[model samples]
Target: QAQIVELQKQLEEVTRARDGFQTELEQAQKSNTELTENNRGLTANIDKLSRAQHEMLQRARRADEALRVLEGEKEAADRAQGSANTKLATQEKQLKTFLEANEALESDLRKQMQRVALLERRKLEQEAEQSTIEAYYQARLDEMQAQYDRLLSEIDDSKRAAQQEVYRAFDDNAKIVPPSPGGGRSPPGKAR
Candidate 1:
């Protein structure tokens, strides 16, 4: 009978151990179900992060391309501005030279005008002097002609007076003057 009680106690202990093992198995299965759900959520988050990273890389590449295009445009604008500055400087120099040349030409023209005025004045003076000299010579020629005419008239009057005196002297003497040795003053039959 004591051996029978010991056997019954051993059987009861075995049944209790079996019941604890069954509880442990049930807890393990419940934990496994929760862990599976957590793993699925983690995987979804990883996929979302990877997609965001890819979009950021695409945006960065586009920004770099935009920066390169802007740099090229700036260089082109700078080169154009430099050329414009150089041309402006050249045009300014040319304008200054033209202005100086025009001033010099104006000065020369003024000098030429003054010289022409002086020459015209000299010509007028010479013409006036020539007129004066011609008038003086004409007056001298008129005085000389009047004096010559008077001297000729006086000589003619003296000749006429001398002829009258000789004729009177011959008449008073009352002598016949022979014209030549063969011709008497009157003919023989016609004595005067």
Candidate 2:
């Protein structure tokens, strides 16, 4: 009976050890399953990161290209501005020369106007002098014509008086003298 009790106690100890080993195996399997799930999640995250990095590289290349184009446009604008400045400077010089020439022309026009005015005044003075001379000469001619008419009338009257005196003398001589042999009287100064 003591051997039988010792065998029963040994059987109970064997059963407890088997239960402990079974519990340890179940815990190990649970840990392995959790590790596998974590690895799959990490792989998925790595794939997403690779895609994002590719997109960023393409964006960087495009940004570099846009910068190059902007730089070319800036150079073109600078050249155009330089050309415009040169044209403006040339136009300013031409304007200055035109203004100076216009001023000189105006001065010459003023001088010419003054000379014309002076000549007009001189011409007016000459006309007035000529009119005065004509009036004076016309008066002198009228006086001379009147004097000539009076002298001609006086000479005509003197000739008529002399002829009447000679006739009276002839009549007186005829009365005093006798008749001639031929019955004709002789002229006052002739002998028959």
Candidate 3:
């Protein structure tokens, strides 16, 4: 009976040890299941993060293309502005040249007008001088004509007296006297 008691105590200790090992196994299995579920959740979140990262990359590429297009447009605009500035400078130069030409023409016109005024004044002076000369000549001519008429009248009077004396002498003597060549001779139907 002493051996039997000792054997019984050893069996009871072995049985308790087996039950404890079984309970530990069940707890281990439960902990593994919870850990597996947590792993699955973490995998799903990683997948979503990966997709978000891909979408962000696509958006970045589109933004880069848009920036390139805007830069092209800006370059074109800068070229157009440069061309316009060149055209404006050319036009301004042309306008300046035209204004200078107009000023030169105006100066030439003023000079020509002054010349014409001088010529007109000279013409008037020449006409006035010619008129004075003509008047003086006419006055001299009239004076000479008056003197010639007076001399002609005196010559007629002398000729008539000489002819009367010669006729009276010839009538008293009853002698024929020759008529002088320069006597008061008159043509037919005309008086001396």
In angstroms, give how far residue 143 of model 2 lies from its true place.
Answer: 1.6
lDDT of 1 by residue, 1-192 (tens): 444355455545555554555454455445445544554554455455455545545554554555455455545655778656665555456545545655554565555456555545555665565556555555554554554455455555656666776798767767876578546466667859
Best by TM-score: 1
Each model's Cα RMSD = 74.6, 74.0, 73.4
**Cα error, candidate 3, residue 127 (Å):** 2.2
Best by lDDT: 3
Model 1: weakest 10-residue lDDT segment is: 1-10
Candidate 2 per-residue C-alpha lDDT over 42-140 given as tens digits, one digit per residue, 9 for 90 to 100: 455545545554554555455455545545554565577766666555545654554555555456545545655554555556556545555555554
Q: On TM-score, who's better, 2 or 3?
A: 3
Q: How high is the CA lDDT of each candidate model?
A: 0.55, 0.54, 0.56
Using lDDT as the yardstick, the better of models 2 and 3 is 3
Q: What TM-score, over all chains together, does every model reach?
A: 0.43, 0.39, 0.41
**lDDT score, candidate 2, position 14:** 47
Candidate 1: C-alpha lDDT: 0.55
Q: Which ten residues in a row have the lowest lDDT in candidate 3?
A: 1-10
Alpha-carbon error at 192 in model 1, in Å?
A: 24
Better of 1 and 3 by lDDT: 3
